[model samples]
Target: MSKILDAFLNENLEALRDQGLYNEIDAVEGANGPIIQVNGKKLINLSSNNYLGLATNEELKQVAKKAIDEYGVGAGAVRTINGTMDLHVKLEEKLAEFKGTEAAISYQSGFNCNMAAISAVMDKNDAILSDQLNHASIIDGCRLSKAKIIAYKHSDMDDLRTKAKEAKESGLYNKIMVITDGVFSMDGDIAKLPEIVEIAKEFDLITYVDDAHGSGVTGKGKGTVKHFGLEKEIDFQIGTLSKAIGVVGGYVAGKKNLIDWLKVRSRPFLFSTAVTPGDVAAITRAVEMIMESTELHDRLWENGDYLKAGLKKLGFEIGASETPITPCIIGDEKLTQQFSKRLVEEGVYAKAIVFPTVPKGTGRVRNMPTAAHTKEMLDDALAIYEKVGRELGVIN
Candidate 1:
């Protein structure tokens, strides 16, 4: 590294370490299931975003293996080029059906999906009214749009309405869009889409909802937009294939025209290599499984409720989460990091989430209970939480 660059990196690295903000990443030894092996210790995992546990499904694995034989490994090129495979078309079709939209377009991942989709449509002349606590992807995508971004208080409909009205009345913007996460990942609060839609209509604003965390966990696995019955109302419905779908891509589900536009305009779709045939096939299978039955979704909720109850009983502040994602809030950054370290030491793999991810002083160890976890597993994990809580003075 160059001298100036090396000095800059060293300074920031030391700053993060001194403040207890540097995170130590542990490599999972095998499959990222309910039980994870990290550093030779097998622990009950509450750290993954695999809400439905389809990532390690045996049936999906076989499907992917079969796909490799039929369609080969790579997609060959980008979507606009020779990269768009039949499997790609099939996955997008499945995605549209899965999200209950007229059509859909896929991306390499959820984060880039946001970046590509947002910048594709909005520009400097337009304005994007985003939720304050929207995911980092959404925040970055909005910035990339080059649009004047106005942040509304998270899920606060009154503030959203006021901002929408102001943006519309100002006439300073040619097109205005209101964007929010269908499910706020940190707090697991469902977005006020009904009210947001109403506000959008009142101001003729375009609506975008990134239901990345809500798919397969809400709306009986259809997603948050379908959960609210606003499939026809929201212009953009973005989601991740990695989360509940348990694959490796992202997509925007909307009207056929919007999908068509994204196909041509979204930079990732135009330039990036499409998902591999094996992964695309697996993703389609996962979506089909989710659509076929709510058994997994129901099981996930049951597990979430059980874990939340256990954590609350232990006097940890499990934030207001309507969905399965549970965050055990610890106010101080260092204590939260130490708390997570202690949990891992005691045989649980819940990691600490701190600054820049969430606001300062609101550090937490977010717990994700999936459909694959048994009651026995959750009970064991809860027992670990209790032991750690008492030892760390986080609970009575």
Candidate 2:
């Protein structure tokens, strides 16, 4: 309530509003499924990261309900303090099996996973070669480690190789790590993990991949590491249970030693309360479902393709997205926000992404078509897009 603090907040907030950079949050009326209700208006949702539609799967819901009856809702305390639960242990084991790793350790969320794991293994004496478009969590994690961060051009293998070679040859650090997102969320592009793995081997750099947007949506639902068969080559496989897995937590899958070290040293795991018993149970079941069948994953990709094709055919500047995440690029910030608003007004809830989430002047309305979306739903969305696109002059 100090005058200085009030002035600082007022000035920055006004600046953001003037520049069309301030985000307005909307509340979903019920579940965040394929169709959502906002302010009592039902709409086809295209902005969720729930890739495989597992978030609303009936079987998973039943599993969580059963778990709550048996184990209660909360886990009581941190894993180290109150001891780990059986569900927690089972989820970790399933995660390791799913990722084809020797062991795995869980965290409160995907963002916390990166923040904990990176700083635990690397320190001031180490250096990290990070991709330019990695998630904000990875960037913060590298900073937390106090390591010298060398950013390469986004998915530019040549730039990565040059940086890796220079960092290695300089002998300026004890350990060098290369980190990237398995899938760039904004562009929906898959990272070149094969090339990155090759470069890592040549430079003896420790490899870390944050596949938050890839799991349960790629590699028949195993992930990008498995998509490229780099299970053993990549040193760290980081992911979230919240997205495709449809739960609430994050994890790192790797060698037994790495898991052991993280269990002891990762601050989040050591300090934060363990995932709720119900969530842990449901996460284990979700991973099992992904391992047992690829029906959801296949349907997700089909929806993605259908949506992307429709957007492109309408003359919208859909970006180069390799996965199911589709982005309709609108260069001007205000216009992009207006486009998103129009889509929402027309009953399609595709949100505008701008500023720090991506770069200025490259605003977009990102769409994520999940497995739960039927052809009829998609057709309706496309029709809405056409109307909005024509109205906004985004497409002919």
Error of 2 at 251 (Å): 0.5
Clashing pairs in 1: none
Any runs in candidate 2 off by more than 4 Å, and if so which?
Answer: none
Tens-place lDDT per residue, model 2, 1-396, is: 999999999999999888778999999999999999999999999989888888888999999999999999899999998848998999899999999999999888999999999999999999999999999999999999999999999999999999899999998999999999999999999999999989988989999999999999889999999999999999999999899998789999999999999999999999999999889988999999999999999999999999999989989899899999999999889999999998999999999999989999999999999999999999999999999889888887
What's the lDDT for candidate 2?
0.94
Q: lDDT winner among the candidates?
A: 2
Worst 10 residues of 2 by lDDT: 81-90
Clashing pairs in 2: none
Worst window of 10 by summed lDDT in candidate 1: 79-88
As a TM-score, model 2 comes out at 0.99
Off by over 4 Å in 1: none
Give lDDT per model, in order.
Answer: 0.92, 0.94
Per-prediction TM-score, please? Answer: 0.99, 0.99
Question: What is the per-residue lDDT of model 1 for residues 121-200, given as tens digits with 9 covering 90 to 100?
Answer: 99999999999999999999999999999999988889988989999999899999999999999999999999998999
